[model samples]
Target chain A: MKVQISGLCKKYDGKPVLNIDNLTFEQGRIHVIIGPNGSGKSTLVNIISGLEKADHGTVAYGSNQKRFEEVRGSITLVMQHPYLFNTTVFSNIAYGLRCRGADKKQTELLVKEAAEKVNLSAFLTRKAATLSGGEMQRVALARALVLKPELLLLDEATANLDPESIGIIERVIRDFQTATGATVVFITHNIFQARRIAERVYLMMGGRIIEEGSKEKTFGNPESRITREFLRGELIF
Target chain B: MDNITNGFFGALELILSGNREVYGIIGLSLVVSFVSVIISMFFSVPLGIVIGMNRFPFRKAVIMIINTLMGLPPVIAGLVVYLLLSRSGPLGYLRMLHTPQAMVIAQVLLVSPIIIGVTLAGVKDRGNLIQKTAFTLGANRCQALWTIIKECRTSIGASLVAGYGRAISEVGAVMLVGGNIKGHTRVMTTAIVLETNMGNFDQAIAIGIVLLVLFFILNILLQKYQGA
Candidate 1:
């Protein structure tokens, strides 16, 4: 449940996006990464989750220091814009289970449990295509949660949600973290969301982790000007 | 002008009365077109998906060939089939010339490329998102393919309808291969041709009306299937 990333760098079309030296996420903790758009927060998450390859770096997991292929099954990523299958909500949540060869009974139970966890049990039979943006994000969360991965990655997972839905999602996420004690890495541009969810904060700027500490220190007493400006909502690129 | 009106109404009356000749032509046309469409679906849909989803050497060349075949003249296809199945030809031993089976074979060849080309375009356009999402969900190759197929079901339906329309309306290939044999291979298109040449405008128009209605019905079904 521990991940250590070092010397991670990525480039697209010869332009560098993410260039990180070292960072670590402890088990049973919520880590939030905050930055402006195009600051490479998403790129870092993508590289860690095995969604994209790093040009140079090593992402080691646990005491044995396993690589991505060895630890991929233990990590799940929910992208910024959740992609739902053109099927019922029940099927969408049950997809991960089905992929892992869960039987019909197990699949139904897990889907229902995950739906209830996310407060979406009432909409299980509805067509996924007809759901609102917030509902879709909940479905995505339910899908990831049902897998019970060791590390969960969220990329602006609640950005499109209404306040009510956002609150519900936040509570569900907090409860899941408390109950399962899994590591969570969340990315957001919303400063308040980071403040609300994260125990530890990593302030990223220009693809590097500029500041890292407890959420109270990073948000309350910033050391970097970039961090100061970002917290005050003055940083604009 | 008077003849046209009489022919149209007479055809409608024949349809209502269940005239055996009209029924025979209609039934034969349906069988030929349906069989051709089934065969085309079997080959073309998978071919289209594979071409759309994977890349290989000469993939573009293969696609270009299929696209070229989509616009192939029906008469040219007929001529080719006629040559292959004619007596003393390579496949002449099967004695399939002037039979409904020969017509089905010709129509299958004529319409398969159309189905493949159109379905390829549809599959390629929608494949990326489905692939990305399915892979992220840990779907292996086969599962990813099934997901893409499910997502592109509407496009597949459209391709099938287009193939059916082309197969049923085509007179040249069916006429050449089937030879308009009465009660055996006399499909609507061929019957219409034969009746018109024999100065029987009423029967020709009757078959033509049936063809038009069949096309309309197929299109309606396709629309409903896609909308669903």
Candidate 2:
């Protein structure tokens, strides 16, 4: 889905946190949003996913420009610190399908496929609480992926994951996009990771998008000075 | 020593002989308390989930009221119910006093706040995280709230046990509203009290033993149901 945000603003305790005049995410692309810790990336995604309300602005999705409520079932978000339900991994992964009223046979098939994609088929019967951090993250990913969302939002999903886990996640993201033509918005702090996976890059600072372009243009020849400093690791944020 | 021995033997004899009156009292106690807990659940579970999961005007005030009522005295609850069901009172036309239904009503008044308070505490502890996770996974508001209730099942089960413990073990409210009529409103606790006051120590101790054993057995059943 192509998502557009216009005149967006958010505040916490009367202190402005995010302000975006206009931003567009093209359909079927990996759009990486890179920013430092307090840059409102998470907040923006929360509003986009309709988990939170923006103080001002409109976030519209798809060709019809449907609001978040109208298209909520087609959007899914994986959080930075994902909460796996206190049950078997199979149940957690099958939760979304159950919510959508998928039948038992179809849910079982899709959950297995999702677990296989994330290399978690062996852990399906195990309790979710017993998994290590990386395993838990994979469970979260499988849980989201089984739903086949049109818009997938990852908020620092692989921040502290091991290289093997990261590789599996990146491969899953790539494969999912190729297979479904879905829009994937990845939020991260590591610039090189962005370079590796982002087809389009959005650099945000202090609640605003400082620069955005294709990966090569933004990384090699940026228009904004702050973007250059950010790329060079000299900016303090 | 002799009374204790006699009471122990009397309890065994009552069970083995299938004493109808003793069995009836036990049955009535279980029925009244279980029905009260079920009625309390119908109100407390949904209200607790809603109040615990959302922020609205006077939420703090409402929670404070429920917490205060969690410690509400059973005698006070009985007195209120008694007055309300009296002929001159507002609900006199229901004609529900001195009956099992009256006992159930009084116990409901005593137990609802406890379930509500514990539920609120449980929801406040982990409800937000569960609700947010459910929402991000494409659950609607009702679905998300239901997920929170399910995920917090441990605490909710604790609340149920607590409410049942209070209802089954209590003597004040039931005695006041039930009137301890023979073959009618007489429950185990009231039977024990009447026997003790009338110097029938063996019978009182036998009834007390039955009460503890019944509670233990029911507790195990409830836990099993919760696990399932």
DockQ of 1: 0.39
lDDT by residue (tens digit), candidate 1, B39-58: 88988998899898777899
The estimated TM-scores of all candidates read 0.85, 0.94
> Evaluated with TM-score, which candidate comes out highest?
2
Which residue pairs clash within candidate 1? none
Q: Write the per-residue lDDT of candidate 2 for residues B1-228, one digit (tens) a residue.
A: 997888889878887788888889889998999999999998898788778978999999999999999988888988999999988889999999899999999999999999998888878868888988999888878888778878888778878888988898888888988899998999998999999899777678778988888789768866774565
Best by DockQ: 2
lDDT tens string, model 2, A107-129? Answer: 99999999999999999999999
RMSD values, in order shown: 3.5, 2.4
Query: Runs in model 1 with CA error above 4 Å?
Result: A4-9, A21-23, A54-72, A220-225, A233-237, B9-21, B47-70, B79-102, B117-126, B177-184
